[model samples]
Target: MNPNEELCLCFHVTQRKVANYLRIENPRSASQLSDCYGAGTGCGWCRPFLKKMFDAHRAGITEADFPTSSDYAKSRSEYVKKGGGTPPPGATPVEDLPN
Candidate 1:
């Protein structure tokens, strides 16, 4: 198995684990995952791999489940707030955007 698969296997860390950390813990960036989950603290070797997992996890979410635009907007606003920018005008509200 690859290193990422190996870490995932050894830690039993799933895409869900990375996703939950991003969604619930709201890690603002890749470095934060290291602080939160020891995901990137090792020899600096697995950092990029961990980040890819996190990105993949976040990228896998869907937006159709949110019931309202306002709720979706709120989530989008939060993501942008964490992301350090105003959301683009064309940007879909949170629930609508790619995870």
Candidate 2:
């Protein structure tokens, strides 16, 4: 996802926000990312990406591996359709998706 794209769609947490949080907050583990605006706590789609970012930080890499925003949102919509997760009330709807 792009820096401005919503990585955690359920809570509207952007990739930039998570990246900054990972850098500034210096969380000890991937799970600690939840404290950064309820990121992966909702539909759970972004958990892997969050973990990926954390792992990269620990490895001293500043870059992250992520799908394009469209691909990510499309996958998320598919996941939702398959009942992989249910987004919270304030989350971006599966049908309406991404900002």
Highest TM-score: give the candidate number.
2
Give me candidate 2's TM-score against the actual structure: 0.92
Candidate 1 lDDT over residue span 7-76, tens digit each: 3222344334555567777665677876544544433333455676556546764221222434433543
- Give the residue spans of candidate 1 off by over 4 A: 1-16, 58-99
Q: What is the lDDT of candidate 1?
A: 0.45
lDDT of 2 at 53: 91
CA lDDT for candidate 2? 0.90
The estimated TM-scores of all candidates read: 0.39, 0.92
Which clashing pairs does model 2 show?
Answer: none
Q: Which run of 10 residues does model 1 get worst, by summed lDDT?
A: 1-10
